[model samples]
Target: MNLKDLPIDAQPREKLLARGPAALCDTELLAILLRTGTAGRGVLQMAGELLGKFKGIAGLLHASADDLKGFKGLGGSAKRAELIAVIELARRALAEQLKERTVFSSPDAVKDFLQLHLANRSHEVFAALFLDSQHRLIEMKELFRGTLTQTSVYPREVVKHALAVDAASVVLSHNHPSGSVLPSRADEAVTQTLKAALALIDVRVLDHVIVTQGASLSMAEKGLI
Candidate 1:
């Protein structure tokens, strides 16, 4: 049945307005974005079909524009743009929150920020959090992207960037797209090499965080630093 045929409380739009977005199911949320469905299908039905086809919200969000355009209900360029915009907004919001707060002082904040930025990625990424002498955030820079298992990190380049920014210390981070937060032998060796290089310029290496979708590991906490 169409949404209009359902009881007011049973409708996704009505329920959303009455309660909150957090209360809505994934299908309902997608229905709102889709707005309407084809001639015989209700918005909710279309949403369910789309979710099934994409294997869920994460798959849909990460889908390429061409992939989305191939889908019946999501073929329009406007719809594709809207979905991409929402994802970008979410990433930017997390980044902005990290910038506005004390990044290093709170371990939870750092984990949450890094998780939001790196967890959902499909490949490896190496990033740095440059902090002032007080441990306040100076800047967050994404230095490299690599294959599923490894990335080539140059300690000399990292030191150069730290000096350019006058960073007193830094939190090094990289994601394992394989979803394992355990630091490999190579990860440990590179962290040590970067630490030694940065120390030459008196820029302390505070921590090396290994990020995955499910968890993050701190090298300092593990006594690896």
Candidate 2:
């Protein structure tokens, strides 16, 4: 059915006016971006079809203009215009996401800082957050990961890696698929061993954190770090 053929208040344009832009669907949102459509289709319908083909924003971001232009009614210029619009959407999404880590004072702050990025990961990931003497974050690096139950990491290796990265202080973190935030016995042993090694190198071991699906535990808060 034609967009304009719908009841005036029931149309995307009307709903947007009544309830704001958040009330709009993906297609409706894209229609706002497109402004106009080609052939007999309305912009909303074309956008709906395009969103279906591209999945959501992620899939759309991965699509090239050439691929988009191949869509039945999309011309090269139309595809290019839509792609430019999509790029802006991607930029806004990134901009609205969590800010870069600056300083990590408390364990809760560190977990809260990282949980956004870590919570959605599919596999176990070990990250080492590097810090300056002031405890301000310099950067973080993924150290290593094991399949399940264990990671074959070494304390000496941790020290070696820290030295290579020129890190003065480091915070260790790992995820648990089973949703238990408690550190395993092996985790305790490895952390202590790494602490000792890093101590010798004059690099500080700030904290070791175990993250679950919903909660996280910090060894530093428990005097483990």
Candidate 3:
């Protein structure tokens, strides 16, 4: 679609002015940054190619600027700017999701909130979800990263981060890069270790969640702790 041929006042920018910004998706917003495209491609086409190259929005957000620099037209400063914008959009999305979260009402909400942010990762990251007295989410801090079976999640550090955030409780969460929701011995051990460690500080350990592609396992639900 030749955006320019649609007339100056009828372009997406113009339509957005006449309507609103929520009318666009990630690719559409990216197309706006692209502005123009190569002879055979439109802005949407190029934007789609960029997203496809990285997999999806999450993958694209996680991709490094240098890696994106390899794309023929995506090289140089303008391309880097586009890449930065894409990641910024994701950051804003996650930040917005966290805003005004006073406490977690249920296990399902926690899974829903973090699932997209973690599902695409290839490495296991132990994350601490800080919660206030009411169980609302305060912040999510990454404590450690490792392979499938060896990820070292330190309970002390998790407690420390919670204390720093003035959190009254915490939910431990991690992704199974292999797409298995089953908790291993290490996972159970870490959970018990963390539960005990948090007890010393008087901070409640709400749950330990293992997120997979299709579902999540909560230690609390499984009676693992």
Candidate 4:
């Protein structure tokens, strides 16, 4: 049956309008984005199939443009483009939120922002958040990207960049493509090296956060710093 043929309250769009977006489940929300259906399936049914095939919303969001283009209902260029655009907009909106707030006052916000930015990535990425004396964010930089198991992180270069940015403090972060939030021995060694090197220049190392697909771990919170 057509989505419009359903009872008004049973419709995803109507339910969303009646109860707001937060009231809709992931499938319902996704169906709205998909907008239409195949010959015998409704938009909601197609959305559900896509979610199941991709392993839910995270998997779908993490899928590459080429990968999405190969999906059944998403094979069309216009739908694939729409999906990619929506994902990028979400990332940009999250970044804008971070820019408007002070990192020091909201440590949780930093964790949330980093998780959203890096959690779905298939490869590892190392990033730094530079802060001024007042702990306001000065800059956020991605210093390196690497394979699943390792990324070459340089203490000297991190120090150089910190000095160039004149950052008073820094928060370090990297994603584990393996979906494990546990920091490896190399992760610990690199954190300590960077901390010590940054200290020589009177810059403080606040935290080193290891992000995974589902969660993040803070070294400072673990007393590793």
Candidate 5:
């Protein structure tokens, strides 16, 4: 059924205006952004299917343009562009918040930021979040790629970039494409190695976070950092 067929109060736009965005379900919220549906599928159904296809909003956060292509309601450039833009805006907003406050103050935001940047990759990516003395974000850099191992992620290169950014501390991150957020033995070793190397330069290793498509694990919280 089309959105117009729904009761006025039940429509996503009208519901949001009357009761606020939080009153809407995920499908309703997404339908607002999608605006319209394909020939047979209603906008609400399409949004729900899209969420299911991507495994919910977190999975959608990192979807690339190519991923949207050939999708039913997203065949046109406008819908695809809107989705991509919204996702990017979410990322940038999180980044701005990190820059404005001590990262630890909102630890979940740090994880969310890293997840958005690191998760959903087909290969391993090792990255760092350089922080100022106050632990505000300086920058996030992808320092190495391929399988994450102690040998593959060079401490020298990480140290170099940390120095270049003049980071007083760093939060290390990497993605496990296998959908498990558990750190491997190599992950722990690399974290310790990078921690010791950064310590020599007076840079603290705040944490090492492991991210997958829908979840994250913080080594620091687990006392591994």
Candidate 6:
């Protein structure tokens, strides 16, 4: 069950060096991060257990330090810190990409940026990606929390933030903790309401994205926007 017990080429580090990182499965890659395991659990076993507990890599990466507490191999601060740091780095990398290029040029990146920010929440969150005239990201703000009914999300507030950021266009985003990225009637109604309100100020609503832990849906792509 130990790394040494495996054939050298079968070990995580050995396999990574032999065939590159893409060749390693999630467990092997995570085992390398973990380094070692508890007295009884091997690193691969511990890694598998962690992934299972969290539901997979995306769930694990988004896990908070407190969420990792009491886990066998992750009881130490170092491993937990590494995991948290990785996710933060990914978010910053995506943010940097959005800052450097037009969002429309790579729509998947925008969805990824929103997914990393909005996914894994236990409740609904209504957020906006305020963009510059060239459609590059200016800021992403979480404007409303709790249920995302039209009543709960105020278009006036969204318009105010858009003006404050000097955004010429905006992408609306929200998370469905229920794991369904399907936009409900409320989602459509609020998008239209915000679209109308922003139009009054000469701001454009570019897209409305619904995100969950593992998937995302773009209203613009669906012609719902």
Candidate 2 residues lying further than 4 Å off, grouped into runs, are 1-102, 106-109, 147-151
Greater lDDT among 1 and 4 belongs to 4
* TM-score of every model versus the real structure: 0.81, 0.55, 0.76, 0.87, 0.96, 0.94
Per-candidate RMSD vs. true structure?
Answer: 3.0, 7.0, 3.6, 2.4, 1.2, 1.4
Number of the predicted model whose TM-score against the real structure is largest: 5
- In candidate 6, what are the lDDT values of residues 19-101, reduced to their tens digit? 99999999999998888888888889999999999889888766888899868677778988888888899999999999999
Better of 1 and 2 by lDDT: 1
**Where does candidate 3 clash, by residue pair?**
102-136, 103-135, 103-136, 104-135, 104-136
- Candidate 4: regions farther than 4 A off: 147-151
C-alpha RMSD between model 1 and the true structure: 3.0
Q: What range of 10 consecutive residues in model 4 has the weakest lDDT sum?
A: 147-156
- Give the top-scoring candidate (lDDT): 5
- In model 4, residue pairs whose N, Cα or C atoms come closer than 3 Å (at least 3 residues apart or on different chains), thus clashing, are none
Q: Which wins on lDDT, candidate 1 or candidate 5?
A: 5
* TM-score quality measure for candidate 6: 0.94
Q: Summarize candidate 1's per-residue lDDT along 93-125 as a digit string, tens digits.
A: 766666676666578878876776776678888
Worst 10 residues of 2 by lDDT: 93-102
Over 1-225, each residue of candidate 3 has an lDDT whose tens digit, in order, gives: 666766755576666667777776667666677787667887778888988887766666667778778865676788678668776776656555554564444445567556756766778888878877877667887778885333466666777787789888888888998978999998988888888888988998888888865578888889987
How far out, in Å, is residue 113 in model 2?
3.5
